[model samples]
Target: MKKIAIISALLPLAAGLCGAAGKKPADDAVARANGIAFKFYAAEAQKPGNVFFSPYSMYTAFAMAYEGAAGSTAKEIASVFSFPAKTKDLRAGLGAIKKDLERAAKDAEFVQANSFWAQKDFKFLPAYLKTLRSAYGADAMQADFLGKTEAARRGINAWTENKTRGKIRELFPQGSLDQLTRLVLVNAVYFKGRWKAPFKKEMTSEADFTLDGGTKTRVHMMAAPGTREAEYGETGELQAVRLPYAGGGLSMLVLLPKEGRTLADLERSFSPEKLEEIRKGLFNQKVKVFLPRFKFSSGYKLNGALAGLGMPEAFTDKADFSGMEKGKRLYIQTAFHKAFVEVSEEGTEAAAATGVAMGLKSMVMDFAVFRADRPFMFFIEDPKSGLVLFMGRMQNPAAQ
Candidate 1:
């Protein structure tokens, strides 16, 4: 199967906020949800692999479900997602933030989509539908989950594939959705940006990449000559670099851990506050940088991981999605997420999509010389909305 991932670990250490008062609440909500997400990753350190995800995708998909959640179900979802106490505020903040993000992506093909699917004949509450349409830009569509489950699955997969520019397909997989499925809230985001200071293709050459286990791997190292001033930052354990795209509105931030320190080590101690410190302290300097050419896709089964974040009620029979329908019979059965990213001398092409079976539950700047020759953490974001479009760590750049 292709690489599809559930996004919960994208921004364990992202530290930036929205400037507008209206968007601050939404940013705060995502920030808190990030806390739970990274914590879940730390708790599941036993799983072996590099971290990759789109937390924004997961947050928005869940927010769609949270709108219809009532009583403890709503409370649990809010607590898990770190939403503000009031629903009105959450909606307003999210709306402002969404509009700002949509506006800030002129430089990149940053497309975001949301949708709601319910079994045919299910009477969805008007207020719930309105919340999805108004606050999340989603329209509830009736599907015959009981009579045409496979067709419904293919339709959803097709929608996700189209929205993601064919980057994410087969998100639900065979039999993942069934006749018992009541509702699914979907989110898709696509981003492709060319670096303002593109690396010359001729400069890419063979280099040795050191893996965490002390294994050496041959990879294509991309070099950028030290001519133009670059923004950079470094502390005891990390070196950071900011590469602006064709338009200055969006950029990619690469965080390389110092020698002898592993990306896993930084992840264990990382936080939004620490990321902020790095962003604030960067300086402009002349430096030679080497980044490996990497391309890979990732997918995850998030049911267990999300349950670790608290809010198991949303996944089980106890889920209360009454805001969606009169009876408290709907619950989330499964959730799926897939992400794709490619980094070359030209620029970066990344896309991510999320699906929530609500059947019922569940950036920076600095100046300094930076070389990302080793495994490192990176994020592509639009600072205006304080939303991370893609976040992942590269272990073996040679691996596709």
Candidate 2:
């Protein structure tokens, strides 16, 4: 997906529910979180084969930990997440957004869950727990990471699978957790929705798709009628459209670059400001929509990427999460993210799970010709709420 997608999802935080607690941040923290994620994804991680991930999931995971951060560590995380410097405002804002998301999820086949797995008998500050539960809807579970590490891993994985309807499985690779692991915080997001205007299965046909390196392959391009006055726009080199789901709250946005341009070319200049302009540029229009049917899963080990985003202290001995516990006993060792996405004639299905294992350790728019026959970016989000559940690019549907 275009790096801009991450920034867009953050907009929801800025647009709080009508009756949410306190006033929302004037500077838009969610946008800042998305920006940090893109900086890391573009420069450090994002691989080519149909990239799919939930910036929401990763950011929420870190956010839970941020509640427990202190000193410069807290300052750095606040900067990274665009959190209000005042703790109470941060809680009120996120708690309000969480309530809005819960209400929206109840109206659709959507689920976003957060859980905290702590070593048995490890004493964590109660205030930290309270904030996580109240602001993020996180549940705390005691696990024997100090003893039955494998079993703890299995339990966490089971929670993810059940929450995501099995689309995500075995979130933590074997050996990801062990005796030294003190706390594991995880967030899982799942979404299944039908298109408001479904594409005809019979209209799908073989079409040529070009990859970044000039490689071309045949792909299953699906088509739907285009006189619907959909949300769409185009620039000289790029086209974008927003394809809404059945509920109207969520939509899939596709970004297609012109023949001579590449997704990388569009990405290089994608910043929060430019992203706001593109979003504002969307207008109702009519055009044929042809999208390739593709499904893929991506997994990332995030130590390097998080460091690249300027929170290197969290992974080192210099870390301080004292607000969570005494003696500064925890530092993130590794962070893992796994996501799955599929789009076809009927609709879209996406799920993502993100976890951080501590050694005390720690860590788009739419349419025009919008024909995604070439390398392109895509993202699924709630326009009203500004929540981006999934984002990725189908650079080469046939790659893996």
Candidate 3:
């Protein structure tokens, strides 16, 4: 989906208010959704340096997390992710989920109740009408609909601009938005920091990268000797690595196609469940990493992928968004997602509050530098919510 603009006025009035509140739980939900979305994207991007993440997965995860929090009829929640032929299955899913939440509620019940509306509804059973009215005014509700539509557009544009450093424009195009839209949520997190150890420009040299179909391309490679955690795993035929962030709380998982393996194979096998497995199996180890400072821009149309994932109803005019109003005509017209990412180990400098060098050299260093010259995957997440707001893979930096 090149331009994904979901305007969901039917998003249970309570959910919309909770989402708009910008509370910790909402933020956490967004982040977790982002993380799940990124994993799917990374798996797809692992193909032969031509990988593009799926926007459908990102949108689905976001909708699911929101549904998990907002108390909506099982059918309503499923509609947000896509439509289901049998509402029974959705109710079953919700029943199973409710049981899980009931157990979790026993401990940290207060925090859970406050953070999750579903839990709140089950526990306190607040007056839904009063909460809805207080949380959203008529004007605010109208504005929310308009704001979500525009925000979705802005998000795709921002990701494209940020990743490509301003190469792609209007990923969704103009006039792609329409009313009766069911849902629109976006998360844009960026990290532009320096490396603890900078690469020497003179040491950078041309290197051969194995591409798909037994092809080879000469690219500039940077090498650094540092204590870094690395891993090797498989998403079908693709080989991947997990690079931890500075705090070790989160990691950047990079997937690369094995020699002769196409990126498509990896994308086909990508899923949130698989990603969680990969994350759990990641182990910390020391290694000498060699990578290129590369940049590349990509655009994707995710309608097909999303529809394939059991969310087919939102795409058509037949979509029922009655919750938005007793009688209203609304459906998602289009979904477009475009993103760009550049990774280069070029030197970067930053100032710190304390300037001290507690080393053998005893020299005061007031700045930090970084050079990202390798194809890498990265995300910034909240430790509590486990959300990943921003994610990208950079294969070529100069081109971007």
Candidate 4:
């Protein structure tokens, strides 16, 4: 597992560093919390294959502790991870991640691989929860925290099954979850909307889609007419485009290889910063949106990724969580995250009725064209906390 390497690298540093004299536990806590969040996104981006994980849920739990312990050492702990003494504006840093999120969300094939990993990791949840409570104090934990944890776990499982159209079950199997786990908080968000404008199943025709190599394979390409926010740029020799979400709060970003360049070359040049720039510069423009009707799922084990990002002490059994409770043995054994998303022409619908009506008549015009043909990334974030509630990548839409 990738986590093994992270632990190996940080064990030495964790042992050497003692609690700074009169150091506030809150500061360390926040640092640890934010470190974990940052690592999830960073690792997902660095991993060779399609990647997806939820840093939002993880942050929500940590945020609960930060809020509950406000003015105490816990607040400082949250700040460490959140503010990162060295950074000026954490929001700016997060905003820059729009591209990566967009890529992960839109890529169908990547989503499938990610969901497989998430389901596999669900098997170890029982032992994982035990380790959490043992390290953090029972008093420091809240009843709501437990409830949310359970709900989030179940919600993800349901989403996984739904996204897979019932092909997979028990994304997190029974007997895997625990009630007494020392969890911080739970953050869950589910999005199941059809495309604003449904494609005429007949319009979908097989076409050649360029892959990583020079080979061109036939894929079912879904074309539509719509107004989408996008940007044109030349990062080295590749051509790229950015697709913003409804409110412009987040976006789906794609990098297409220049005529002669291969997808591999574009992938090689991809970076968090470049992705950010693409998002920042996006403007509403009229264009032909061609994509594939694909579906996929993804799962991730974040323990190692987080540790490698400079949060070593929390994962080890010897780690100190006294601030949460004096003399309590607390260490994070495993951090598991999973997500599922589908983008089609079929959107969501709601209806309301009034007791008194005058010749009631209603007309609804719900039309949108979102064709996700190539690999793309996406994220659902809490605008206030800058917390990423859900994140995923899809490379295939046909699976849906």
Model 3: residues with Cα > 4 Å off, grouped in runs: 1-49, 52-171, 178-187, 195-202, 226-240, 257-277, 346-400
Candidate 1 lDDT by residue in tens digits, 80-152: 7777667787777667667666666687777888877777776678888788777777755777777898988
Query: What lDDT score belongs to each candidate, Candidate 1 first?
Result: 0.71, 0.70, 0.37, 0.37
By summed lDDT, the worst window of 10 consecutive residues in model 2 runs over 7-16
> Which ten-residue region of model 1 has the weakest summed lDDT?
7-16
Residue 17 shift from truth in candidate 2, angstroms: 7.8
Kindly list the per-residue Cα lDDT of model 4 for residues 256-358, writing each as its tens digit. Answer: 5445654445445555445445545544444456665544445444456545655544555444434333333333434444444444444211110000000
Query: What TM-score do all the candidates reach, one by one?
Result: 0.90, 0.88, 0.53, 0.54
RMSD of each: 5.4, 6.1, 14.5, 15.0
In terms of TM-score, the best-performing candidate is: 1
Q: In candidate 3, what residue range of length 10 has the lowest lDDT sum? A: 354-363
Off by over 4 Å in 1: 1-17, 20-37, 40-46, 360-369
Question: Against the true structure, candidate 4 has what lDDT?
Answer: 0.37
Residues 1-400, model 2: lDDT tens digits: 3121111100000000321355454125455445554565576324545566787777778777777778887787676666667777766655656665666555468787888887778777888777767677777778887679899889988988888788777778797777778778888888888888889998899999987788789999999655566888778878888998886777887778877998888888876566556667888877678888887777777777767667788777788888778778777767778888778898988888888776654203243366788988777765655555566777777654
